[model samples]
Target: MNARVLVAYGTKNGSTAEIADVIADALKEAGLRSETRPAAAARDVTEYDAVVLGGALYAGRWHRDAVRFARRHEHSLAERPVWLFSSGPLDASAGERDIPPVPSAARAATLLDAREHVTFGGRLEEGARGFIARMIVKQGRGGDFRDMERIRAWARGIAKEISKAGPASPT
Candidate 1:
């Protein structure tokens, strides 16, 4: 049977959720069974063989819900093959080079023993409710910086790694 992977994410303006969907799609294409969920709504990981947790960066900090999810599911997470991602920075920096995880994400990686943590570009557009977000869009400094191809490629790598393991073990 194929391994089931949970692609969970926390997003303020919904862009991060879209990223999670893309990741799940790539995982499925790579022959893994995957599901995408909002970090705050997902309550358990016992059914999944692996997890890919992602969050939106805010002022150098990870989204609060993502941090909470890690805390809530730490034990199950520790037993599973895990990956982390952060999507923020409405610029091309993520595609140009590697960006390290923020403080909270770093802690989650250590606590869960995640196989890897990756940073991806972000998008901020009109209709954002946050003051800073609205201001950035108004100032024309906000745009989609997420690289879809890069995101898919990274997910494929995760699929490859998981495929190399023996049959999926229940956690």
Candidate 2:
């Protein structure tokens, strides 16, 4: 697909950004033009044919920058194909699917008629923390649980969707 795809993310300790980078790479491998950027720093979505918005979850909430970006570009996003993803479950063995930290923020998906909303495993490094997060890490719930294969599969799915819709003309 020749469509340009944006893999924008909001991360606290940079894990989510890493995931976004992998997803962007996967999209490129699938023959789509893709770029990754921090949601807070992304200028505008008007130039992209499709978007994949992702963020890290904390305390039952998605990173604020992702939510703000979705809200700020609701109308523009609603006009194009959009996908939503959340990464925050530190334990992949817990079978934690559908644990979106900010379901309300996912309203952007509804507004845009999004193709999918996925929740992937996350990572918690040894020393990365923010106050209460340190306590959670002490509980032995820290490690990298991100599945690169799963992430790549999801990006391929996005590429398929883009291909099905054909290239989108800039709005």
Candidate 3:
């Protein structure tokens, strides 16, 4: 049985989108069928056997659309196997050990029965910034700090869980 995984993301400078794609590819490579799409563009979660929700974090919060998506579909999502991920904390100077901590958004989602939630490092494009974002970047901070190895391992774990469970209709 093929597990249908929906990898949805909300991005500003496209970093989160790229992460979503990576996750989708990993899922596919692990023998699951996956689709990556923006949160706003997602049709419905009912058709998917598992859902991986992701979004870029800004100012210690998840992108608004992602939060809204989760709220709107909380009931439906609670009925299935769900996971969440975030792209934030571009400061890699902390190495892999001192990346502050996972913010409340990721934590709250985990409390909602998410199988897993990861905080991958985010990115900052040179010209892709608003006034506040620009200021943050100008502070000698901000750059892509995504850890692909960790991401791959996380995806592999999710794939294993889904494969073991097989595919099942929600409710």
Candidate 4:
């Protein structure tokens, strides 16, 4: 059976959600079964063989919903293969170097025994919520800073690892 993976994320302004979708797409292309969801709406982790959790970074903090999700399902997540991601570097630094997760995300990774955590470039186009986002846009600092090809490559690596592990054992 194709291993089912949950690709869940917490996003502001929709960029992180797009990244989650890219990850799910890559997994599917590698002959896995994957589903994408907003972390707030994903109430369980036990039904899936593996999970990819992500959050949008704000002021060096992981998004609140993603944090809560990991906590709520901590034990179940620890029982399965898990990966974490963060998206919210409006600059090219994420592409140029490996960015570390904020404290909360780092804690979650340790708590869940996650295999890896990645930070991806973020986008802040017009219509992003919040006053600071608006100010950044008004100041002409807003643009799609996300590098899609790099994101895809990262997801493919995840797929490769999962595939190498073979199909999930029956629950």
Best by TM-score: 1
Q: Check candidate 4 and list the clashing pairs.
A: none
Query: For residue 162, what is the lDDT in candidate 4?
Result: 84
TM-score of each: 0.97, 0.91, 0.89, 0.95
Task: Give the higher-TM-score candidate: 3 or 4.
Answer: 4
TM-score of 3: 0.89
Q: Clash pairs of candidate 3?
A: none
In candidate 2, stretches whose alpha carbon ends up further than 4 angstroms from where it belongs are 93-101
In the order shown, what is each candidate's alpha-carbon RMSD?
1.1, 1.8, 2.3, 1.3
- Estimate, for each residue in 57-104, the C-alpha lDDT of model 1 and write its tens digit: 988999999999999999888888999999997899998899999999
lDDT of 2: 0.84
> For residues 76-164, could you state the per-residue lDDT of candidate 2 as single tens digits?
88778889888888888424456543675566567667778888888987788697667777888788999888889889888988998
Flag regions of model 1 displaced more than 4 Å. Answer: none
lDDT sort, best first: 1, 4, 2, 3
